[model samples]
Target chain A: MSRIKACFSVLKESHKKALIPFITAGDPAPDLTVDLMHELVAAGADIIELGVPFSDPMADGPVIQRASERALAQGTNTDDVFNIVEEFRTKNDSTPVILMGYLNPIEVMGYQHFAEKAVKAGVDGLIIVDLPPEEADELTAVIKPLDLDHIFLISPTTHGVRLDKISEVASGFLYYVSLKGVTGSNQLDIGAVSEKLAEIRSKADLPVGVGFGIRDAQTAEAVGRVSDAVVVGSALVERIAEHAGNNEKMKKEISSFIGSLRTALDSI
Target chain B: MPEVMKNTNIDSLKSMPDKRGHFGNYGGRFVSETLMGPLEELEQAYKKYINDPDFIAEYEHDLKHFVGRPSPLYHAKRWSEELGGAQVYLKREDLNHTGAHKVNNTVGQALLAKRMGKRRVIAETGAGQHGVASATVAARYGMECVVYMGAEDIKRQAINVYRMKLLGATVVSVEAGSKTLKDALNEAMRDWVTNVDDTFYIIGTVAGPHPYPAMVRDFNAVVGREARQQCQEQAGRLPDLLVACVGGGSNAIGLFHPFLDDKDVALYGVEAAGDGIETGRHAAPLNAGKPGVLHGNRTYLMEDKYGQIIETHSISAGLDYPGVGPEHSWLKDVGRANYVSVTDVEALKAFHDLTRIEGIIPALESSHALAYTAKLAPEMDKDAIIITNLSGRGDKDIHTVAALEGITV
Candidate 1:
């Protein structure tokens, strides 16, 4: 079984929800990413979603957009991200690392080559934000053979027919965007998200990770009660952006924030 | 190359987008899942209204009265004589109500929005021509309008910003990456995804997701249709060459779409080479960039090796974009149209020359096409007819031109 499937199976047996913390690789500094990944794992993160900084992250709001800008300014490429994952893999192997970003960089690298490189680099899954299931066939063909989980996003607007189509091709977990807005935008209604999650669970048998506007521990805990996994991105990245000038403080702050959310999810 | 020739059939060229919006491996709905429903709905609406006679009649009536369609194909006699080669004709789209060809697409989209019972319309603009055009249509139809423009563009094209506001549009200044057209497009897409129910996104250019490229092209194809017929009647046959400047390739595609089947009529799309393509500061994506997905479609984009879209430069704010329309990419690949670049200095010279020779102050965007014509016209025979779409008037660019001359104007 793949690392993601194994991780979920372990969590399911323990009757524990998964905590997935996302950070843009090379944000603040490239050398610090591996250490941060390890920190996230230490803070009870079951899965790590490492963002590959794209120049135009349209789906992201101001917070994650700033994270991408910082990462790009530091010259973080796909290879650098792979290296970060490889470095993290040296210390940790149990936690699944999902590389999340837009699709253009992978397109430039060629689907087959990227999937091969990603597998070699110890990437367990991919969450290409812009690439829906409709456009995933070419990449899916290559990655599926390599045992790399192809995670797809299901937004609030995704209806019954599209949900069936997405669930058919998606492996690993399905990321359900809790709100109708971009990542980091406010106004996530827990009731609405719960309702949507119930509908999504009925359609797809995969573990559903809820994200996009889970800002604090309470929100994460609230989402965790209903979701198989709680994914926090812009909130953690915002903390990193706040302490960018001081790497030690940024690392400590990020760890503590994730630790709080992990504690909250465990309590739930 | 030989195989490409054998496949260049008129029917195949016209029957593009093939239901799934693939334009020969270019153009697809690469948007987020949230937008899929809206885009599918839009595709159906476009298919419905685009064929419905009542919708067609409404669009045509607006084109005639509001947009001032059948914009004259004026013979640039003095400019042609000065070039001393080809007889040049200008399809005067600059004479449209909003001072550019952008209004043609906006009018069509606004009408579509009304037909679909949409209350609000949102658009992204770079040079603000499309913003002004969208605002004009929104005002005409009494619909709420919002335009997203790059902060850099909002500063450069303040007059157009004021014009949009005057037309009752709330212009949102985007300060994202590059602070330009691509960023504005990103914001617009985000907005559309957020408000997918009641809002309609009127994409300015012949780019974006599926139906947008095809729909926008169909709306703007009136430029080509009129130019083709006028050229035939005025010159007794189709012109040997057609030229237009490409930003998101709306105007160029507008003029070239109707003429794509005419094997004898060559097409040229002039991209803005800000300093030079070699200097790496231009917006000539087709000439110097690689294939990548951005905004909503896969096309030629000016990107770094890591696939990060690089900042593009052009004296014309409209053309300063990292990507071109997908159809242009397809046309370039299929050997149907030739893409070239004109430097800022060359476009400035063309702007001046056209003003002096023809008493026409063409937009810097249009001046790129005129600049290429100045080079190509002198090489062709005097009897050779060349038709160029003068995409816009230069009034909005006077400030930029004056700034180049060290004047504040």
Candidate 2:
């Protein structure tokens, strides 16, 4: 079994929900990313999502957009991100790392080249936000044999036949965008998310990880009950943005925040 | 069927997209899953209405009455003589309602929105020509309209912003990445994803996901259709060459699509080379950039080695974008059309020459095409006829030109 599947199976056996902490690679500083990934794992993150920053991240809210801008300013590239993952793998191999971002960088690298590099770098999964299942054939064909899970997102608007199509192709876990708006938007109705999660569970057998607009321990705990995994991005990145000048404080703050989310999910 | 015959063999050109909207590895529906349903619905609706006689009739009728169709194909006699070469003709898209060729696609999208029972329409703009066009059609059809424009563009093209507001559009200034057309496009896509139920997105360019590039091209094909007939009657045969400026490539593709099969007519697409292509500050994707996916389709983009989009610079706000349309990418790959770049100074000179020689103040965006024509015209014999798409009027660009000349106005 793949690292992601094994990780999920272990969580399922423990009857515990997964906590995924997302951070942009090369944000604040390029050299600090591998450290942050290790930090996230130490803080009890079940899965680590490393964002490959792009010039334009349309689906992201302001916080993540700033994260990307910072990462890009630091002159981070696809190889740098892969190197970060590779560095993390040198220290910790069990923790599954998912590379999340837009599709252009991977396209430039060529699908086969990206998949080969990603597998070698120990990337467990990919969450290309802009590439839907309908258009994922080229990348999917390349990544499928390499044991990299092609993770897909299901939004509030996805329903019926479209939902089935997305669910069919999705592997590892299906990311459920908790709200209709982009990340960092304030309005997330937990009841609506719960309802959607229920519907999604009925259709797809894969574990569902909920994200977008998820902030604070209480909300994470509430969301943890409804889904198999709670994916937290903007809230953690906002802390990094806040303490960006001081690397030590940023690391501590992110660790403490993810620790709180881990604690909250464990309590539930 | 006869329409297909006037060009080259229809079978080769018409069989494109192949149901999945792929224009030979360029165009595809590469959007988020939330948008899949809406895009699929849009595709279905487009497929149905594009063939419906009643729908086509209504579209044609509106083109004739509202947009003032068959916009004149004027022979630029004095300009041709001055250039001392090819006899040049201008497809006068500048005379369209709302002062640019943008209205052609906007009107088509608005009518489709009405038919789909959408109560509101949203659009993104850089120079605000498209915003004004979208706003005009929204008001005409009595639907709510919102336009997203770059905050920087809002300041530069304040007159067009006022015009959009006057036409009943809520102009939302985007302060995102680069603060320009590409940023406005991102914001518009966000809005459409958020409000998929009641809103219709009217993409101004032939870029975006799947159906948009093809649909916009089809709507604006009137430019080519009329020009083809006019060339036969007025010039006694089809022109030897066709030239147009390409930003997201709506206007260029509009004129180039019908002529794709025409073997005799060579096509040239001019891109904005801000200072020059060598300066690394231009929007000439085909000339200086590589293929990368952005804003829903695979196309040539101004990106760095890391795949981050490079900031594009151009004197014409409309052409100041990082990517071109997917079809243009395919055309470039297949050698169906040639892509070139013109610096701001060259385009500005063309802007002045056309005004003085032809008594027509062309938009700076359109002036890029004129600049290339000026270069190509001098090389060809006087009997050679070249048709250039005069995409817009220069009225909205007066302030920009004035600022360039160190004038307060």
Candidate 3:
């Protein structure tokens, strides 16, 4: 079975929404990245999404942008991201890691090579924010050979036509953006989002991961009531960016944050 | 080159680069995979249009009638002796609408956008010259226009930002990293990703993925074509030297395009050395940068050890850049064109001298080119003619100059 399938099997058996926490690889400093990855997984993250910093990430609002800037300022690149993953895998290997970011770095690294590298680094999936289904085919063609899940994004603006298009290729989960705006925007429309989740479920068999505007415990639990995975990115990125230089403090804050998210999801 | 087009002014005998993109070693497309299809499509379209009898007529017709082409090749009578160089003549591209040579390319690309049935136009502007030019044509063509500007640029060039809005263009002040031209480019790329189906990205300079550098160069080459023909007709011989400022190097390439085949004419590219190149405070990418993939193409870039782009500084907002067009790389390697730079102090001196002597105020961007002429002209013979492109008039730069000099206008 694919790692995402195996991961979902755990979620199904436990009857708990997956607590998906994200942190930019090499934020604050490159050396501290691998340690932080271990703390989050141990703290109750069912899955981890590693952000590869691009010079411009439009889908991200201010918090994540600052996180990425810190990571980039510490001189992070594709090599650094993969190395961080490899280090995380040295001690703990079961937690599925999803490589996430824009497409430029992947394009620069070449699609086939990036796929092989990600698989080698023990990556389970990808969540490129910019790659639409039409463009996802570019990476999917290369990644599918490695049995990697190609997660896709469906937003509130995504209509009947685009949802159908996304359903055809979405694997592991469909990332339902709760808001139309960028990550860390104002508020999530619970009614509209659940309707979007229902709309996606009608056409596809994949589990839905709701993100973008999910911040606190209440918000996470509220979204987890409807979606299979509550993917919290900006808030976690904000936490990392805030405590970048202080590693122990950063790990404590991150683990506590993810633990609360996991509790909220379990309660839901 | 035949100069008539059945009431069309079609230049029938023109040439294109070979598959590897070599235009006599002065122009060629050296790029990566990100821009292959777009560049190929652009090359095919540009080749077809430049040779097409109808395209020539319409393009040249607009250049003459609409844009008021063959702009004055003025003899700088007072400035000539003041610089103590061979008498200098400036091909006044600043007289073109939108106040720079940029509109020449915008008009061409906008025409192509119209032909492609695209309704929305998106562009990235560094100093807002190209943004204003793009907005101007978008207004004329009745297309929905959106301009992306770095937040820093929007603050500095507020006048041009307002001009774009006045022309009914939506000005998006991008607040990404550095908030400069490169950031604006990143924002425009994001916008393109979102709306690529209906939008045409009007790149400001002869740089970007691939087709953009070549396409922008071809369109703006009107400056060189006009200057060369007019210089020969007026002086009865070609200039000893031709000069223009280099940012993404479009103006330099445009002015050098027609003169490259002229073996007698020496081409000079002038870059802005903001403080001094030695101080590591300069925008002279050709002189101080290394080759790298930046701004979607392979070219000379100002990057640090880990490939992070360094901030470039120059008094001239337009010429303040950390990279140059790739064709400039081919030119520098071939020894076809020589590039040099002038410090901000020298450019400002040239700026004041030109305003005082010739009653001509040049944009600080163009003053870098004039700085080269001011240095070289005095060393040449009286009969040795040096022609430099006065790329834009200096009205936009006057406040900047007054602020620096603490002089009341």
Candidate 4:
């Protein structure tokens, strides 16, 4: 089984919801990323979504966009992201690490080469924010055979044939964008999110992970009650931004935040 | 290389950007899943109304009365003589209402917005021509208008910014990467995704995901159709060459689409070579960059080896984008349309020469095409005809010109 599948199965068996924390891979500094990944695992994160910095992050709101800018300023690229994941795999190989970003960098690297390099570097899954399933076939064909879980995002806007289309090719988990807007914009209503989650579950067999407004332990707990996983991005990235240029402080902040969410999910 | 549409098969050549929006391997709906529903909705609306006679009549009626369509194909006799070779003709898009050919597409999209029952319209602009045009149409239609412009562009095109404001658009200054066209596009897409329910995104050019490229091209294709008819009526034959400047390539594609099957007429797309392509500071993606995805479509983009889009420079703010429309990429690959570059220096010279010789102040974007025409015209036979699209007027660029001359307006 893929690492992501294995990780989710383990969580399912334990009747526990997965806690996924996201951070830009090379944010603050490239050298700190591997350490940060290890720190995320230590803080009880079941899965880590590492952002691959792109110059234009259209889907992201201000917080994550700032993280991308900081990462890019540090000269981070796809190779650096892979290196970070490879280094993170040294001490811990069990926790699934999903690389998330836009599709251009991988396009420049070519689909086959990217999938091979990702697998070689111990990356478990991918979440290209801009690549919808209609345009995903070529990449999915190469990556899925290599046991790379090609995860997809399910938005509040997605329904009917479009929902079916995305569900058909998706693996690992379906990330449910909890709001209608870009990441880090607007407060998400739990009622609306759970309503959508129920709809998403009707079509896809994969676990549904809710994201895009879960900021605190309370919010994570609320989301956890209805989702197989809870994803917190902007809140963690905002914290990273607050502690940027101070690596130790940033790690501590991230660890504490993830630990709180982990505690909340466990309680749920 | 990807078995693009060969120059042969002119009949089917007009049906490009196939059903799934793949123009060869270039254009596709590469956007977030949140946007997929909206884009599919847009695609359906476009398909339904494009063939409907009611939509066609309404669009044409607005074009004739509001935008002043069939802008004259004027013979630049003095400039042609000064160039000393080809008899040059200008497809006078600069004379259109709102001072540019951009209004042609905006008017169509505004109409589409009305048909879809959208209460608000949004757009992204570079030189601010498209912004002003969108604002103008939105005001005419009584829809709420929001224009996303780069902070840098707002400074350069202050007059046009004021014009957009005067037309009642709320201009949002984007202070993001590069602070230019690409950044504004990113902001606009985000805005649309956020407010997909009540908003219609009027993409200024033939770029972006899927239906947008094809839809914008269709609306602006009137340029080629009119130019073709005008050239034959005035010059007594079809022009030997069709030339237009390319940024996101709406105007160029507009002029080139109708002429695609005209085997006798060659098409030239002039890209902005900022300092020069050799200096690696230019926005001439088809000339210097490689294929990559940006702003929802696969196209030739000015990106570093790592696939991060690099900043592009051009004196013409409209031309300072890293990527071209995907159809242009396909055309370049298939050897159908010729893509070339013009430096800022050359474009400035053309701007001055046209203003002096023809009493026509061409937009800096259009000046790039005129710059190439200045070179190519000198080499062609005097009897040869060249119809170049004056995409916009230079009134908005007067400040940039005066600053270059060290004279404060």
TM-score of each: 0.98, 0.95, 0.73, 0.98
Query: Candidate 4 residues A96-127, lDDT tens each?
Result: 99999999999999999999999999999999
* Cα deviation of B180, candidate 3, in Å: 1.7
The residue-level lDDT of candidate 3 at B139 comes to: 92
Give a tens-digit lDDT track for model 2, residues B33-115.
77777898999999999999999999999999999998999999999999999999999999999999999999999999999
Between candidates 3 and 4, name the one with more favorable lDDT.
Answer: 4
Native-referenced DockQ of model 3? 0.11
Worst window of 10 by summed lDDT in candidate 2 chain B: B1-10
Q: Candidate 2: lDDT over CA atoms?
A: 0.92
- Taken over the whole model, the C-alpha lDDT of each candidate is 0.92, 0.92, 0.80, 0.92
Best by DockQ: 4
How would you class the docking of model 4?
A: high
True contacts kept of each: 0.75, 0.69, 0.08, 0.85
Tens-digit lDDT track for model 1 on B182-268?
999999999988887899999999999898999999999999999989988888899999999998999999999988777788999
What range of 10 consecutive residues in model 3 chain B has the weakest lDDT sum? B1-10
- DockQ of every candidate structure: 0.80, 0.73, 0.11, 0.89
> B1-409, model 4: which lDDT tens digit per residue?
1123444343456778888999888999899989998998999998999999999999999999999988999999999999999999999999999999999999999999999999999999998999999999999999999999999998888888999999999999999887888999999999999999999999999999999999999999999999999988887899999899999999999999998867678889999999999999999999999999999999999999889999999999989999999999999988888999999999999999999999999999999999999999999999999999999999988989999999998
Model 1: lDDT of residue B52:
98
